[model samples]
Target chain A: MKSGALRASVQLSRSTFTLDVDIAVAAGETVAVVGPNGAGKSTLLSIVAGLLVPEAGRIEIAGVAVDDVAAGIHVPPERRAVGLVFQDHLLFPHLSALENVAFGLRSRGVPKPEARQRAAVWLERLGVAHRAGARPRSLSGGEAQRVALARSLAIEPDVLLLDEPLSALDVETRDRVRSELRTHLAGFAGPRVVVTHDPVEAMVLADRMVVLEGGRVSHDGTPAELTRHPRTHYVARFVGLNLYCGQASGSTLDVDGGGRIVAAPDEPVEGQAAATVRPQAVSLHLQRPEGTPRNVWPGRVVGVDATGERVRVEVESEPPVIAEITPAALADLRLASGDEVWVSIKATDVHLEPA
Target chain B: MTTPLPVRVLAAVGFAFVLLPFLGLLQRTPWSQLPSLVTRPDVRQALRLSILTSLAAMFLAIVLGVPLAWVLARTHIPGRSVARAIVTLPMVLPPVVGGAALLFALGRNGLVGQYLDDWFDIRLPFTTVAVVLAQTFVSMPFLVVTVEAALRSTDVRYEQAAATLGAGRWTTFRRVTLPSVAPSVLAGAVLCWARALGEFGATISFAGNLEGRTETVPLAIYIELQRDRDAAIAMSLVLVVISLVVLVALRDRWYRVQG
Candidate 1:
């Protein structure tokens, strides 16, 4: 019930899909909702922004009830003090940067002169004052993004929602804009929600990450926590770790599908648990060799994907694992699809968590 | 790609069919007497009345047609397709038929006109106002159809952006939606004005061609052709020039929208 807090429990059903989620963010906290396509990430933001009405739920922003289906108190989007930055920025094509920033203020009954002056201040703060007279179509992508952020922030809303803010930028501009966005987001004194599918962006901008899969929150944790113990296959793939669920007893764990992984003897695991192995820790050899490695499995290479400076080799072993190796190592192994290989993992590298 | 020879030959024929009338008008024009013919009091009166009434009709079309267009393009009202068809009926209906229909509804002894006469003492037929109304009846469809098409194709996301910025529906339409489609609106207005300026059958049937009252340039031309062919030719030339100007000004906009 804090003044700047945002809380929502929404349930909406469409013909094709249903979204039901409950989330709460304290004042001054930034939470990132990361999910794959069609997971209702945008729908969640829309509900909180008052652009969409939930079938049966309540949404409160800054301790004010914006939507309550049972209470029949559904505020329209224009009345809700929520600022939304769409993926493409959606800058008014006909207006100059200064006028675009002043739109919200002018709409709220601010006098033209004062609104323009305040908008000028925001433009200066965002480092786009020089382009204030330029139309949105004339401004560069980075400039437009800064103007969009300024426009949303100029409203001085109780809560801010950004939907895939950096997804529209090219690779080169995304990094620069992302860092600038983080600084701007930190300056806002309200609950902030960012929706994105990129794991790196979620890790960098958000204080906490909420993983949404199939319109449900599959995992919610800090970057490090989620990286260490991913609860679902999507999160496991997101962090590039090989995950397995099994029954763990003492130092050994029996995987559910079909594999046995030995854990470090120091950490005793009991009952049903999950284990994670970093792709970097899995070494592949052409033949089974004698080594200090506690876990070794013979499997056939099912796929090889060369990404950047590393190659990910998918092996159809007992548990089916993905191994990341350098191109030099791949060249030496000459790994390709359908090649036979032996995979080895050190016991210490196998981290286990209770499922 | 080159068009086939038969297609090219047939296209030339069609083009010539359209252009031949303008060439005939130019050939028959009394260039030496044009100055005296166009400056006659009756000719000037008709010209002034035509400009005034057509401008009035164009204004009325914008006021009424924009909202109609918005409803057609944005709303899911019941019988929307039927409503759209009814609104566009004047475009295909003969001008004389449309005028006759208007007479049955708004004439002094007619359905709504009888009530207006009883309660407000207002008569619409045979007045200068009737000319404008008849012209608007025929020309408004052009504006409505053009604007509705533009509205349908416009991006709705900008309006959503406006809402999130604390703009109410009216403000969003005025500031964002209207400006985004301003070009199309201008093109539609010009077309409406041109159509209104050339309206003839509707004005003659519904409003009656009373000189200096409802006798617009087109009606004046028909009346003058019986006695003063040169004056009629001069007035026709004026209308043709005005229409040509409108078409040239709107050419790029029309092509951009269609293409």
Candidate 2:
């Protein structure tokens, strides 16, 4: 059996929603499960952590059968050798920083002094050695989270699960802690599953990203692939790509909303497909540009909003599209709500995926 | 702003209703003769017995009630609501009735007590242990209710974190759960001990006021009231002073409710 491997097929049903997905992570791979709220990202982690038992599932961690419903083998959370850092960094308030980190060792029957020594080493490794004697209440949010991470890592678990690890921090702290967390996770050599709603966090921390929607794995690929060719509407919106779902014949794709767009030559000839065009690929022109290399369409500017250094111009076309242009371009075009505009895209720039 | 006349009058009356009796008791107390009155051999014996029985009762309450509280708070035990209501029944029941119930269950030749006497020659009634049991019967509900409320309000994610850190359920409870609710446990133990010390109707009905073995301060006060009024007043003064000191010391800790 390989070390730090996890394979699980989780199935759970509630009156309002159902979560059924099969997922796996190899040794030293950090898989980020990205989703909107109530999309079962936390539920998936909880199932793997043995905190919530799925109605049906088989879980194998490091080739060990942690839960096999057919065999009635359900290992309890304490015996699973899986570490989970909760969303809020739920550090035990009563214990000092060192004791909280040492809790795992002491519970597993290490002597007090040895456990304390090991905990101190973990604290030092996480760069929180100076706060070893402070209680959780005295520590700031980042410090408490580091203690929580140390407490989880002290067990030397086969799999590490982080549920929204950086969501509880302020923006500045979140950025710093996220980078620190990524560094620490890289050193653990375990199958780490991080659940987060932030696309940037997913892209920065994970080797692979799994996009979950309505409790299903809607997209599974490398961060580059997801960024270049997102599959779902949520992913497309998240990665800021213009996605269209339609049927394709030869190189031309007919989007569902009666608009036709050309796909890349390498894309499938005839089948249901999705085409993703980056917002940057869609150019705004005052008038139709003369060219055989472009797919031009007339659209009404429904709204214009500034995001970061770019302004996103929402074009109310048959199949709506967002064009990311420089703020200077926005100023030159004078793009505002209810303004008429011409949108153009090159066929070579449109990336297509099988829906 | 001025308070309404009716509200002020009603509030004053409510304060008087609770305070006037204690004032009258203090006024009647033979403070000058208190030392001699309380130094009587029987009074000293009763004081010792009261402390012993109440402390013993408190020990039992903590040992048994904490687990019961956890069971009530954390588990999905069937009929848990019914179980909680039953556990709190003693708090509302008349102490004399609770004593009667205890007698039927533990008295010699009564229900389980008859079997105990027949099989092991154990007679529980009218004994020092019986006094403790009677006090415990009426006091344990306080501990259970307080601790269970604390456990229910506690954030359980810490326990989950402990489990992920390889701590078993028992370890989590001891290391994580117990410490988180320590203040409530201490508060509950104090309330239980106080209730046990004030136990009279149950202790008298069950343990029968034996001077050295089973007679507690409350029981001694009752017995002395019929024979010597000054001694009774002295005993009452001692109980009042001790209770006041305990309540005052712990007021901010347990009595000051949080929003």
Candidate 3:
């Protein structure tokens, strides 16, 4: 068994629903399970933590073989040594933050004084030592969430499960708390599974993303891979990628009406493969530039969605594409809704695929 | 319009009718005879016995009923509905019928009682234990129903947090579940004690009315009512005053528990 490795193939069967998934993770790594509602992402985390049992598969945490069908070895949650941080930060209202952390250590035969000392160090590391004596109800949402994370980490479990830890906070507090959570996770030398439906959260907080849909994994890849070429329409829309149904040859590309584009040698195989372009990669021009490039499409801007400081323009070409540009860039290009412009993309940016 | 509506008149009159007896009894209870009537040897013995057996019965009921209520409100076991129905059976049974059931279950001539006596030579019927059993049988459901309702309404997330912190089931129950339902538990125990203290039919029938033994205050009052009406009225007045004083002192706690 390695210090931190988890390999699991979980199968859950109920009267109306079934979930089957195969996943693996390594030490000091974070895998974010992202999906829509009812995707079994939470169920997958629960199975790994031993809170929920999978009927027909095995689970190995740190290669320990916690669940093996032939040996009939299925460990219960109490003995699994996995820490779970619930979405609502389920802190015990009666116990103070310090005592809550010490509870796990005390259960493992550590003396009360020693457990309290270890818990105090953990609280200090998480920068929440001031809240050691406060009960959960008296603490704010952000404060309680930190306590939940500290309590889980204090146990030093082999695996960690975080179920939407930042979703319960206000939008303003989510960013700061997520960064703080990232710091706490960085110091953990164990495998971690974070479940969130937010693409930005999954990207910022996890090394890899697994997209679950209809109780199965639709795609599994790094954040960059998932962002650049989302295999499914769900992931495409989630990552804000502009998808086009197009065809590709040696170095030329053609779509229904998105116009001609260039292709890299390793373009996708023929027949109905998707072409995804990041909105930020599309450059707008007032006229077709006299340059050696693969793609230049004429389109009218149909809609403009101002996201953060960047404006996302939806262009009505043969196959519509959304281009994200900074406010400065939009102003320089003098772009607005109903503006006719030539959009030029380089061969590297004009990604191609089979129609 | 000046006389008020017929329904309002009838409601006010009905309330007055209910209060008139207590008020009249208060005014006519021969204040001069109250002291000697309550201080009499027989009266004192009945009061002491009532308080003793009722307190013991109430303690026993709370000990056995609270965990059962917690299980009913939290677990996912099979036949939970059936288990709940059995728990509430005593609440629906008449006090006399409950006493009869206790007799058939633990009496010398009944099931399991013969062996209990034959093995240990212990007879439960017609003794102090009989009085405790009868009171408990008719009063425990009050505690169970109240605690069960409280447990049902409480948030169970705290328990899950305790488990993640590595507290076992028993530790969680003692430190978390009990305290969470503390006020309700106290309220239910108070109700059980009051019900047991005022019990009459079961104690009189199953344990039999023996002076200084099974003749509780309610049974003594019944016996005295047949002989001397004035003394019984004086005894009833004393009981009312004691009840009012206890209730006034803890009225706020009781209301909070109920809400």
Give TM-scores of chain A for all candidates.
0.92, 0.88, 0.78
The candidate scoring highest on DockQ is: 1
What lDDT is obtained when candidate 1 is compared to the true structure? 0.92
Q: Candidate 1: TM-score?
A: 0.94
Cα lDDT of model 3 by residue, A170-224, tens digit: 8899889889888888888888889998787899999989899988899899999
Evaluate model 2 with DockQ and give the value.
Answer: 0.72
Chain B alone, candidate 2, TM-score of: 0.95
For the second chain, the TM-scores of the candidates in order are: 0.96, 0.95, 0.91
Taking the tens digit of each residue's C-alpha lDDT, what string does model 2 give over A116-221? 9999999999999999999988998899889989999998889999999988888889889889988999998879999999888998899999998999999999
The residue-by-residue lDDT of candidate 3 on B1-259, one tens digit each, is: 5666998889999999988989998887888877898888888888888889999999999998898887888788999999988888877877888788778878887797887888989788889889998998888889999999999987776676566666677877876778888888888887888889888877777898888888888888898899988777877777777666766666677786556
Q: Which of candidates 1 and 3 reaches a greater DockQ?
A: 1
Query: Model 3, which residues run further than 4 Å from truth?
Result: A14-16, A244-270, A279-350, B1-21, B32-36, B74-79, B154-157, B241-251, B254-259
Error of 2 at A1 (Å): 14
Clashing pairs in 1: none
Tens digits of per-residue lDDT for model 1, A184-294: 999888999999998879988999998888888888888888998898878998878999999999888899989899989566889999999999999999999697999
Candidate 2 per-residue lDDT, tens place, B1-259, comes to 9999999999999999999999999999888888888998888999989989999999999999999999999999899999999999999999998888888898996899999899999999899999999999999999999999999999988888888888999899899999888889999999999999999988888888788988999988898899999998888888888988998888676655432
Which ten contiguous residues of candidate 2 chain B have the minimum total lDDT? B250-259
Ranking by lDDT: 1, 2, 3
DockQ of each: 0.82, 0.72, 0.37
**Position B76, candidate 3: lDDT:** 81
Clashing pairs in model 3? A272-A355
